[model samples]
Target chain A: MADVEGAVLTARSRVEVDGWQEAIRASCQPLLEAEAIEERYVERCIEMVEDEGPYVVVAPGIALAHARPEDGVKRLCLSVVTLAAPVEFGHSENDPVDLVFAFGSPDSTQHVSLLRNLARALQADLADKLRTANTVEEVESLIQGIVQDVKED
Target chain B: MTTKGNPEKRLKVMTVCGVGMGSSLILRTTAEKALKQLGLEVDLEHVDVSSARSIDADVIIGQAMHTEEFEDAAPVVVTISDFTDVEALKGKLKEALEAQGWLT
Candidate 1:
């Protein structure tokens, strides 16, 4: 594990953004700071939304911003950005996302287990809590809680 | 390419994604939530696009970009805008099941 919480805490909380473009950039900042990904990675995530029509809106109020590892991923990482006011991702069902989870992995298989745990935690229905988080510490606590839950499972 | 029209057969649902770890698992969780909400049951799995080549599923679901790769692996390939919207997923699965005579 590459310290999911540490990887995430690299980005300070940004409460406001101009739009999804800003949102994706804000979300990937920590990963970029950590050198887990490069600028092109964020651009690729944006390109994916524009080209594929916002399939990243994995759940209501939650979007996982990601692209091919070839886009610019240097390591396995998870980063996040939360908004006080949600922005539309053009998704018919799960539109207007407030929480965006940015993931970068070396390949399809490298971070499967780590991401698998995160996926289960998301499936545990933490979107509302994560979306409402006001600070990075709160987010880390939430993530730490999930990490604990992941360990227990 | 086995499209068993039998209403009694347990539907085998598979979710696919570009790499499959994060997105596909999320989709599977979303699919299970929807199916459970509608009182539907099935055997569901999640796999990456590359691994999806040989998996036999009654209906393979995924985001639009990577689903086309699985067209030959399943009788039906269901594409969706978002993988986590339970309502949309429920609606699509119902439509597919209805078309198969699995639902009235």
Candidate 2:
């Protein structure tokens, strides 16, 4: 997993979007601005949702949007977006997502390790908490808290 | 060994995501957690949904979007929506296993 020592959490912790597409854009724009990924990566994420029907919605209220690295990735990055209200991803199993997480990597392997670390945080109810957070700092604190717990463990 | 001669053999479970990184990894973790809660240890595989053709697992666990990809390859397919819900996942996994005679 990449080092989180100087990592930053860039999320639209609280925002309202008209629909899932907006949600996806909002979630990934931060990574785009940070130069962690190219605009095409964000577009690819949307295209995937349009083609695959929101399969990225992993949990009832969480959507982890991403695309192939070759689509457009400059660096490894993650962005979180929490909608003011839930938006349907048109899937029966994992729809009505209120928290969207967009991620990017230079390749599959690097993303896997990053996700492995994220899994630890998510398994600890990180997404569930993100639903109610009102600020990006709160989101950062939640993620940092996970890092602290991991270190303690 | 195909384990065909033994009735106690475990089933192979596979999970897939579009990139085999983001959603797949998340669901994989959730699936493992559910398996642990069920107190059943098993072999699981993860793959990119695009490469999901002719998989070798007895059971494949993934989102509903990938169900069609394994229409003829796998013997059992379990599609999930809420990977975070371990209780639901355990119930579904048990059902999939029992349906395929992998669970008694």
Candidate 3:
């Protein structure tokens, strides 16, 4: 109940990056700019990918970036980043990721419920359509649909 | 009976990730489901990667690059590049646990 909710994003409509760090940094900009999270949280997310390899791709094209709240978190929020060209997160067998959803939660318990909703939204066929979307509006609409679904549930 | 072949008792497992929020949770869910299907009742813990070096668990599952960070702390470790396929994940984990005499 920190008054933080999910936001639909159009900022990551056309991100092209060489590495996983760049991809995470580029994608999480919207959340970082909105004061949705501490500045270091962005770096922490990138560091997670760098140190652990890319395990963010929960499903094809969609990747969720996160780290511990204790690292630096002021609010509970969600931001979406959709890449123009899918970038590799070091997972050799899986396809490159275009969607990077960043989360900033205040606690572990809050994170589980929030993440569960996002995962369910992304694992479905609807997320597949959003992955190949051509316009920012298309991406925004897809995120809107998912957020609404989460609210309803 | 533990699928790990250790009839003595089933092993407790933990999966740590960067923040224990996003990908880590997903991995935990997948891992728990996979272990259950194999008849292994693993106790999965979601710990932040930063503090993983301090937490105590029977076996730690996480990204390969981070294995070294917890190598000294955890007795058993299963570094996974991908958990998208549960069968492949179980196979790798089985091998690790078996080596520890926790699995058959």
Candidate 4:
């Protein structure tokens, strides 16, 4: 499994965003700051939503934003951005997402384990804690805690 | 592909997403657990939507939005609402397998 400590680039809680696009951008900001992905990566993710609908909204209240690795990924990294107010992504079942997870991988397969761990973490109560977290540290710790728990399993 | 519960024949199950690396992989994980609980053995792979359309599989599972585009990709295309819900996936997969006579 890809280690969460290395894959996680940033974690922010209760962030204010205007809409789904803004929320995605906010989630990608840390990846950009860490030079994990280029600007085109973020644009591609937005364009994917525009072209493909809101399929990235994989679960209720959650959106996973990503594009092809060639779009512009410098390294493998993940970002978590929890919205202060939930925004609609046009998904019928998993609409009005409040938690956005953006990730960039150098290739197609390297991040599968990371996503597996992440999937397990999300299945836990991480979403509820994320919604109420106030600081980035709190969010990071929460994620780390869950990822650690999944690792033990 | 062989439909009966033959240990020699493993069904090809493909899980797809827009990019394939993210949500689809998660769906694959959930599907793996679901298939195990349902006492089914199958080969599973995750692919991007574009690539998935070109590949052949016995069953294709994906989000409702993406699976809508894969109507002709497989014998059975399953739409999953939640990628992390094993019970939901198990129920849906059981239905699809039964419909195909793959489950007895």
TM-score of each: 0.73, 0.86, 0.69, 0.91
Model 3 ranges with Cα > 4 A deviation: A1-22, A32-35, A38-40, A43-63, A67-72, A88-97, A119-129, A135-153, B1-10, B68-76, B94-104
The window of 10 residues in a row where model 3 chain B has the poorest summed lDDT is B1-10
Candidate lDDT scores, in order, read: 0.74, 0.75, 0.67, 0.85
Report the C-alpha displacement of residue A34, candidate 2, in angstroms. Answer: 1.3
Q: What is the alpha-carbon RMSD of candidate 2 to the true structure?
A: 2.8
Taking the candidates in order, what DockQ does each have? 0.34, 0.64, 0.28, 0.72
Which window of 10 residues has the lowest lDDT sum in candidate 3 chain A?
Answer: A1-10
Q: Please give, for residues B1-104, the per-residue lDDT of candidate 3 as tens digits.
A: 35344456556677876666677676676677677766777667776677766677778887665565778677688777554456667888778767866666
* Candidate 4 lDDT score at position A147: 58
Tell me the tens digit of each residue's lDDT in model 3 across A31-148. 7777767889889888876776676766556677877688787767676766667777767555587767787776767666555555555434556676677787776777666556
Native-interface RMSD of candidate 2:
1.8
The residue pairs found clashing in candidate 4 are: none
What is the alpha-carbon RMSD of candidate 1 to the true structure? 4.6
TM-score of chain B of 4: 0.91
Q: Could you give the CAPRI-style class of model 1?
A: acceptable
Candidate 1 per-residue lDDT, tens place, A82-137, comes to 77678988877777888888888778656555566666677666676776677888
Per-residue error for A28 in candidate 3, Å, reads: 2.4
